[model samples]
Target: MFELIEPIATVSFSKVVTEAFLALGMRNYWDGYFAGRAAPLGLAPAEVVHAVFYNFADGEVARHVPWVWGKTTPEEAIAVRERSSATVLRRGIGVLAEAPGLVRVADLAARAAVSAPTEGRALYAALRTLDVPAEPVARLWHAATLLREHRGDGHNAALLAHGIGGTEAHVLMALTLGMRAEKFDRLHHLPTARLAAVVDGLRDRGFVDAVGGFTDAGRQTRERIDALTDELAAPAYDELSADELDELIAGLELIAAARYKRSDD
Candidate 1:
């Protein structure tokens, strides 16, 4: 049976983490850190709850501040805190107001005897079909659920990459730039044969010409993928409090920063 509490808990915890990061302009760091660590910690209901507070307190402090890398000083960190706090306040208001609707959607899904994937897809389609304002958030939740449910051997990441384009590198780049590398890595840890099959699927689709190469068709495919993701995420923005939005933006920045840092290493 589908557990309504699990999804709600996961979504709420995720939102909290995202909001906390935004307050410090450390969204990317949080996203990347969680992306890498979420599965390793185990995606259990209790684990999800524990992760929120733990990561919010420890992860942000350790990963987000550039001072750890000597890019900023103590005084600069204070200034960032002031600015990020204001942003967080605004985003929090938005997300709190919109959260009830999201919960309602989850409740509806729980009543169905569907699998999480099916429930998520149905929820996503229903959100769009019904013109719900939280459609974008719904889609993101759906994607997250799919990612979480299949977090081994890079299966989820490869599938998402294939859906976007054939080039695993490009997909990795996009996800790392937009999400987190740890998360990307978790989804792509497949054996050699499975990896080859994933690559072959992309080649067949003309989404990629090689492992790291992009075909003209692949570029077009990527464009479509971006469009769809954007379209799906548009509705959820309305529900985010100013704090949540800032956190999400910050998370994106952190992911970008982490990606660059990795490249530098």
Candidate 2:
């Protein structure tokens, strides 16, 4: 059931899809990710990106904004990622794309995505303005991307309400999920001193132990944040009937389970 949206939706940002950005002379990791996500916003400034994106370190946001635009127009970046993501999804989903349920799922997903209010949801609002593809496979992925960014925006709001800073949020995730802190640091360009400071702050607040595992209080806090995020994201699905949601989840699971290697990979 959890695979309904994000698991399929996030393929838009996957490395396989981002590789298309490299053809534009963009770097692989940060450049592709930030540019593809922000391109829909049309030459958005770093401040807007920093404000809307949340969570990532400011340095991480700064690394690509403004400059990526000079290398490639937002429309080109958008087209590249969309085409790339669709190719991966189409190849992976194979016969499932032709299944009768697939079109229904895409329609159901789009209904839910557009039904949600856009106020205070920057990423969702921006992405929603784009033309949805006519093809079912592309439409399904587009619907998923809309819902994913919409939920992510709500998740950010949930974190803000709890007074959780960006670095602190990532810190709690690593501790609670049993992920290595070093791994999180490797993905994000957070400064070593900043990471140490965030950990220190969490320790001071009794959120983590000296060795960085979550204390009971920290675990409870994360549970609360997760619960709030789910609550906030629930509105996006309001247009779907309970039965429709079940069908959507089932349909998405079938698509996500499909296997195919990306040619670029």
Candidate 3:
């Protein structure tokens, strides 16, 4: 019953304000959203492979994310992403079409073209320099991904700044989401003993209970970390006007609603 998100007026000024980060966070949601409709895309090995391909569209193959998941060899993962880039991109945009009011999606894409770029987000910077398709949805997808990567890069920095390593952060997040810790131990390639030590540390810090579930304090702490991450990510949007930000929120909400509705069906 703890409030799941901050009030709209306080933490959210617009939909575009957070869609990339929101979308970036919802890999599971996207996986669930795309779960049933795998016929035409020919996504194989089902669950894990589809997720790997879907995420790869927003990221390049050589990056850490594909390898980090532990579902396949890094080489195979890279090849799958690289080979299926166009297919994944096509399917990703197709999901947007399932939503109502695509005119808003187009508006979001156009306004995004006006935002200034920033430094340190290598993927976003590289994406901005690419010669991608001229189609509006494709452009919007790319633009949103750029913003997602920008926010992602910033999130990594904030995590590092807070002295959180990749494994511990993964464990903490998985636990908070009600997933089995053993699953993450495998997914993150963390040793059992190492994961136990991290869990003990979390328990000592009052982040976990005797049974290893999050304490109330742990949940609050997770919320604080999320809010701090958003604060750290805000600099990427510093140059945009209020009007432009509003359009982004509107557009992303349409897409999210459509996808979530599709998910519920």
TM-score of each: 0.30, 0.92, 0.56
How many clashing residue pairs appear in each of the predictions shown? 28, 0, 3
Superposed Cα deviation of residue 243, candidate 2 (Å): 2.0
Our tally of clashes for model 3 stands at 3
lDDT of 1 by residue, 175-246 (tens): 435543223443344455644655566678785565445567866666665455444433334445566545
Tens digits of per-residue lDDT for model 2, 90-116: 877778878888899889888888889
Candidate 1 residues lying further than 4 Å off, grouped into runs, are 1-184, 210-212, 239-265
Query: lDDT value for candidate 2?
Result: 0.81
The order of the candidates by lDDT, greatest first, is: 2, 3, 1
Displacement of the residue 216 alpha carbon in candidate 2, Å: 1.2
TM-score of predicted model 1? 0.30
Model 3, residue 167: distance off in Å is 0.7
lDDT of 1: 0.37
Task: Please give the lDDT score at residue 217 for candidate 2.
Answer: 90
Off by over 4 Å in 2: 185-189, 259-265
Better of 2 and 3 by lDDT: 2
Write the number of the candidate with greater TM-score, choosing between 1 and 2.
2
Instruction: Give the alpha carbon lDDT tens digit for every residue of 1-265 in model 3.
Output: 0111112111112223223223333243232223211211222344433332332222222233333333333333322322233233334335665444555654455345335354655434544554434555444444554455555556666666665555556667888779856675433455568778878887888878998788897777677767776775565555556776666666666555554465477
**Model 3 misplaced regions, further than 4 Å:** 1-107, 110-117, 185-189, 204-206, 260-265
